[model samples]
Target chain A: MRDLLRILSRFWRASLAAELEYRVNFVFSTLNAALGLVLGLFALSLFFQNGHAFDGWSFDASLVVYGLFTTFSGISSVLFVPNLSRVVEHVDKGTMDFVLLKPVDSQLFVSTRNFSPWGLPDIALGLGVIGYAARRLDVDPGHVPAALLAALLSLIILYSLWFALASTSIWFVKVYNATEVLRGLLDAGRLPIAAYPAGYRVFFTYVVPVAFLTSVPADVLRGADATSWLAIEVVVAVLAFGLSRAFWRLSLRSYTSASS
Target chain B: MTFLRRARAFLEVYYAYMLVYRSELLLWALAMSLPFISMGAWIKAADTGAFPLAPVEFGRYFLVVYLVRQLTVVWVVWEFEYDIVQGRLSPRLLQPADPVWHYVGGHVAERAARLPFTVVIVAFFFMLYPEAWFVPSWTETVACLALSLLAWVLRFVLQYAFAMAAFWTEKASSIEGLWQIGFLFLSGVVAPLAVFPEAVREVVLYTPFPYLIDVPVRALLGAPITLRDVLIPGAWLLVALVAQRLAWRAGLARYSSMGA
Candidate 1:
């Protein structure tokens, strides 16, 4: 764990230096992320314009979900997305040989090799929105621990899901589309799960488990019982990660260097 | 070669290219379906007297929004940014044809290929809510189709213009992202413009953003579309064309001056 942390720190330093080479990008990305937050809030306001509550979610609850979605997406963009999406290119070009030859765990190295420091603005904006929403909802401080736990579980599940998809690049060679699928599923997280039709609700809640990503955390913030959902999230995260790791190992055995 | 012949060749090449990337195109189409998330919220609100729309009406509007979205979405900014940054634009610059035409041809061909998928989605939606499906008059259908084509053109030009910012900065996609946030609210992607405050709606109607998605969608849904609605987008199209030409010329000058 310490070695992983040290390697991540080194990677992050390099990423920061690379990003800082373009100062204008810092300004534009910050503005872009801020605009994303504004759009999320604007959408929520539009929904509340028709009613105070949507399905069973109060405005504040929905805002919490929106905030969590932004935060999760920001993290994904910064960490998992940039790294996992590269698996397709690596597999296509036979660059995975180098990744496999690395001294550290291949999955760890592959998943944390790059970071986008610009994505921090989105995370900051998301936390701000979440704090603002919590204030409006008068959320109990007692629930903060549970919400954080759920958030961690959500991240784990999402990472595992992305890992599994990225591993398929070994066979499919075009599995970068998996990132788009992940993105589409995350968009569904913008709304409370209850708002969806029965079939969609089931699909999102169980099949993809996107409902656990944002809505469950937001539900915890809203003082709802999230214990059952948290349990499911933990189980899903473990199963997903184990299966994905096994798949990655199995796929690696089939990989032939492009040069060969 | 004549413009028509050159365009035909480009179309054939890009159609084959798009066929190879059909999964990616389908993934993008799925990613752009954010309207479904909003649809769920609005449908629930409608059931509870929060929204003026009946659940079926919300269903129909969002279903149409989905189709319009698929038809109008543009990724030229990302494509151009990639070309500029990766030095790929240099070879294209030597070609007699404007590289922008390549992008236009690719997008148009992809859309053509995507028609069957769109029809499948529409059919599935209609199956779920047959009562919500409304076929407009033949005249209205013709008008909607024309406006939708215009909308696609405007979106393509606008995004191409935005992508030209790559000549000045590395973060042109950030600008595109910001522009998309504006479109999300102003283009009636999140909700019908009728649901917005009247003053905001009036101002939004005057902007080019609405022409990108809203006007065509409203027209397709058999909603009232005034002469001004048509005229505004027509004027915007002319403006966009001029702007695109200027930006392209200036961007190419900068690119050459930098010896890239």
Candidate 2:
């Protein structure tokens, strides 16, 4: 626990320093994120304009899904996008040698080191949407703490899924393009799972876990109370993380530096 | 050798590169089918007779959106940003043909090679929804195709100009993200601009982004096409072309190649 905290502190400090170097970009990103937040909310309004229920979910219910999507996606942008790009860099430069020399887990370090400090703007905006939606839905403040917890757990599952995909760069250098593939799947989060057909809902919820990132938490927020879903999320996350670790280790064993 | 001869030689070589990566090309084309997936969900919901657009109408709208997305999607921003930053642009500049034109040729060539796959996918989707074909009148089809091509060029030039910002700033990645968020909302990738509130839709149409996706898509689907419709999107494309020219001229002068 202490070691993990130390690493996280160091990572945060590095990100802060890097972000501080480009203050104007940070401000622009914040404004950009806020604009996206407004657009997301407005989109919901437009959908509700036509009628009330969309795929059996109320406007407020779908709003929770959108809110959770922004929150988890913010977590992803903050953690994964920055780090996943480095996988491509490492592959291009044959820099796996440096990673292998580390005493600690190379995959962990690589996956965690590319933190961007400015992504919190999206997180804050997501909270504002969720709060507004909660008011509109008449959700109890007592449920807020549970929603936050679910969001964190959901974020964990999301991070693991991304890391597993990024680790594929060890064997398939071209897999960097897969990040966009992942983003395409994540885009499904914009709507609630209840809005999709049965096959799609099943595919997203279990097969890919795309729905878990937002829909499940939103369902809980709407009083569906699927806490068992969180347990499944934690299990999937751990399994995914382990698979990535194994892959990284096996690839390192065959690393044979890209000297050519 | 003559300029046309050299151009032919370059085209031949570029074609070979694309053939080698044909699988990746197919995947890239398939990746653009997110709109189709969304269409499925919406159509299924509309099938229940509860939503605004009927299943057939929803199919027509989303199919158009899918095609427009393919026409307007630009990965060149990242490609150009890398070339400029890594000094690859310097070597290209030494070539007889203008580097930008050469880059555009290569980009177009890749798209041309993939055209068959794109057509097949579109045909397959259309077959899957024969009732929702929205078969355009021949004149409307020709006009829509023309505007779609213009939208394609507008998107490419705008993104290429945005990518050239590497000459002035180190945070091109963040800038790209900002651009994407803007494109997502303004280009109607998240939802149709028609779905947006009236005031918001009015303001967004004044910008060039919508021409890149929404206008061409709506036009192709046989949605309210008029001389005024053509004029508005045409004006935006013209303005983009002018801005692109200015930005490219300025950016080329300031470009410090990677060797330095």
- In model 2, which runs have C-alpha deviations exceeding 4 angstroms? A141-145, A246-254, B1-3, B48-52, B123-137, B172-176, B197-199, B258-260
Kindly state the fnat score of candidate 1.
0.64
| Top-DockQ structure, candidate number | 1
lDDT of 1 by residue, B1-260 (tens): 59889989999999998898777777776666678767776777677666656898888888888988888878899998888888888888779987878888988899888887888778987897688878789877887788888888888888888888888887788888878778877787878877777887888888888887778877877777789877998888888788878988888777953235
Worst 10 residues of 2 chain A by lDDT: A43-52
Model 2 complex DockQ against the native = 0.45
Per-prediction DockQ comes to 0.61, 0.45
Q: What tier of docking accuracy does candidate 2 attain?
A: acceptable
**Residue A232, model 1, lDDT:** 80
lDDT of each: 0.82, 0.74
Clash pairs, model 1 backbone: A50-B50
What DockQ score does model 1 reach against the true complex?
0.61
In CAPRI terms, model 1 is classed as medium
Model 1, stretches more than 4 Å misplaced? Answer: B257-260
